[model samples]
Target chain A: MTVKINTAEQAASLIDKYDTFLFDCDGVIWVGNELLPSVKETIELLQSKNKKLIFVSNNSTKSRIEYIEKLLKLNINNIKLEQIINSAYSTAIYINEVLKLNKDKKIWVLGQNGITSELQNFGYETLTLDDIKDKELTMENINNLIDLNVGCVVVGLDFQLTYLKLCITLQYLLNKDIPFIATNIDSTFPFKNTKLPGAGSVVEIASFSSNRKPDAICGKPNPGMMDSILSHHKLNKDKTIMVGDRLNTDMKFGSVNDIDTLLVLTGIELESTVSNGHPDVTYYADKLGDLYALGSK
Target chain B: MTVKINTAEQAASLIDKYDTFLFDCDGVIWVGNELLPSVKETIELLQSKNKKLIFVSNNSTKSRIEYIEKLLKLNINNIKLEQIINSAYSTAIYINEVLKLNKDKKIWVLGQNGITSELQNFGYETLTLDDIKDKELTMENINNLIDLNVGCVVVGLDFQLTYLKLCITLQYLLNKDIPFIATNIDSTFPFKNTKLPGAGSVVEIASFSSNRKPDAICGKPNPGMMDSILSHHKLNKDKTIMVGDRLNTDMKFGSVNDIDTLLVLTGIELESTVSNGHPDVTYYADKLGDLYALGSK
Candidate 1:
């Protein structure tokens, strides 16, 4: 059964078990732009204990640098570049280190600037949706519109996604030699008061058109994404705990990686959802701010 | 074994076996507005023999009326409205006779005028992509944008497919009570010596975003499409043969429906493709024109 860290003594006692914490940013740290209650004090308490804090997010729309800027803007201080692990940065890392694609070949992107920006920052040239978004697809210009030099196709969330982008992306993906990668396949994302279709919804069009699955879906819930993180960082599995609000992605990420997980109830999950213990989650907390209760005590 | 109707005697002798002929329009009779060699004389020969010639096409873009206009424009004479069996028409028939959707509820279409025209002609109300093509998806207007009167969602080939159409289609499909249908799932269609993404590729976005398979795929090879034709027409299956260029959709349609199949060249397939007899196909011809040889003889 999953333990509930209700009291300040229990929350303080739970902190002693893990030296490093992997935080899922959206729900645990902040909801959209506004910081959640007691997030600052909780983080300060973790830092006072010298616990390592890493923000692991599935935010494919923002690069690590962009994410860091947002974190600092949120007044969450002392965040390092290496402390961020987002699907965009993870996707770039996968393409660079795992695929080891040649530097000469360009990456074709069916996404926004975050993907291209990260890929370019990683020393790889990219051709994004802007290159062909405005062009019309016709028998006359199809051959010219498709870039044969594109070695990899990366699909992420594009606010301005159109049929033209999907058509061009499908043509490239049809070439078996060209690798297709999706940053993440989150079905939907929260916007204001509701949810909208995310990258998973968009990328599946190219996958269906090509009649092929993506070479890599580099995101949470996939053990390979965690493996990529493990290879980059030198951390002991016993000392780390993944902290998040979502059970399927964040908690499952920890369980598959053989790390512990702490689920907070401030985001997508409700109090009633944790009535039964999930195989992935180790403990449930009222909120991330529960750790700050110990500091006040 | 599949017989090759090479000689006039063989072609004439084969015509006596089937009283009804289901013709695939795109490749067998015509190839993109240009009639195939001897299609007129061959069709005329069949008509003179009192053979029923039904134009079965996977054309979801143009309605039956529009298709008839194209046939007349091409000077293909003696065509009857009942003789045309396009996916657009088949889809409407399926929605009307099989699904029995209420006449009051409106159908939301993610396709061209073909789907809407057919549905509207069949005494059903519809709203196409044009209705929401200009509307932007925002948290503020999501409630007002989605029409609750939508009873079914139809997806077909939309040349003007935009992100807005996909986003709206997904919202309706998410409601399980609203039936989801696809006209066909042909991966690619020939366009001026090139094969472009077809309705299958376009409709999959809604299917994936909604995370569910369509309730019905009303097109060739499904057997359900042929069933729709059978339900409407008083033809003997034993006396019917499906003539098409493609083996998968056309021949398979005949096989599953317990009808014989005639393979014709001059479309997508070549001589090498029919070297061995396929279980579904009964005979192979150099072209649909081979049947015209008997007239010349």
Candidate 2:
């Protein structure tokens, strides 16, 4: 059962227990353009106590810089860009540091600008959907396709995903044993009061056609995303807690990494759902603002 | 072990064994624009013997009429529209017959003209990718969404698939327990001397986002395609044989329905691969034209 940290004393005790708080952005802090109440104050409280704050998100569509801009708009300011880690950034880190992908080899990215920029930032050669589309490559010329320079294929949420893009991605995946990476397979994105297909949809299309599984998924619930953060900062895992609205991605990410989790009901999950699926969660709150109870004590 | 029907006597004996012959088009009879040698004469010979001919294909990009035109071009003439069954038509039949979807209920089709025409033919109010694209539905207008007339979501090979179309299709599939039908989940389609992502790729995108398996796949190896034909023509199952180049879909379709299957080498399968996966195939021929040995006998 999830321990309800409702009283100000209990919340304060829980807050005192952790040295760092890793937050899931969309659900825990804000829902779209509107910021949730008390989020700014709670973060300020944690910062005043010298607790490290990390914003980890699965949204691969935006770069860390863009995410920071959005955060400033929500008034959750004073965070360094280094503390913001999205899936796009995490994927690049995994490729560069873990996979040791050659700087000369290119990644055939089935995603938008964020992934392209991140791969380029890591000094890895990158090819975007536009690169594949601009060439007008089809089956007739596909056989004569000599430039198999791609070392990896990364699939993420692409609004411009096309059949031709998938075909090229499939060819690289099927013809070679190159690494296949997906940022995250989060099925849906809560978009503007409705859900839309996310990166998982694009990954599924390529995986189904190529008949291969992704070698690594650099996102929540996968230790890879947290591994990048944990390795970058020598933080004590025992004193850190992951706060998120979703049990599967956020809470599972925490549990998988041997960190305690706090389930917030302000996102995709409910209280009952957390209890049913993720009994490992250490605490429950209606929203991240409810954690304001912690500072009162 | 696959019994090789090499000699005229062996081929002739096999031909005489079946009263009806269900043919898989792409690999069995033709490879591309070029007709496989002896296929025309062998098919004619089968016709002369008064054997019922049925063409069953998982390719849904083409309508029955268009397929007939292609068949005539290949010189395998005399196949009527009704004798032809493709995944698109089978999906429409499944929706109209098995699902008994109300006439008032519309289907949002993520496919080309083939599926759109078939659904319209069945008198189901239909919306195509073009319809979704024309409206330019986005996340802003998604929540107050008024149009919810869709009762089913049918996915197939769509060259013009867009993100907006996938979003709309996902909405219909997720918001309600609507029938999710896919024409075929064939990973890739042979196109212009190379393979392109097929209907399965499109379906995978929707299925992954919605986190739901298709309620029915109206294509090969599922027996739904064969069921459409069997119920329509009242064909004798015992005396029927399915001939195809691919083992998984065609041979599996035959074996699953208790019909004998003849493996051909002109398309995807080789004599070796067929033996490995489907030893249930009763006979093997190098090509459909190789069945001219039957006529010689």
* Winning model by DockQ: 2
TM-score computed on alpha carbons, candidate 1 = 0.84
Compose the digit string of candidate 1's lDDT tens values, residues B67-129: 678778777888899889888888898898888899999999988888898899889999975
What's the lDDT for residue A98 in model 1? 78
What DockQ does each candidate score versus the true complex, computed on alpha carbons? Answer: 0.48, 0.66
Q: List the residue pairs that clash in candidate 2.
A: none
Provide i-RMS per model in Å: 2.1, 1.5
Alpha carbon deviation, residue A52, candidate 1 (Å): 2.6
lDDT of 2 by residue, B175-242 (tens): 65788999988888776666778888888888888888898899998866777778777889989999
The window of 10 residues in a row where model 2 chain A has the poorest summed lDDT is A130-139
Angstrom error of the Cα, residue A62, model 2: value is: 4.0
Per-residue alpha-carbon lDDT of model 2 for A1-297, expressed as tens digits?
568777888778888999999999888889878988788888988899999999998998877988889889888889898889899998998888778888889898989888888889888888865554445465456654434788898999998876667777887888656899999888888776678999888888888888888988999999878777777666799999999988788888999889999988888777776554456698888888867845554
Q: How many Å off is the CA of A47 in candidate 1?
A: 1.7
Docking class of 1: acceptable
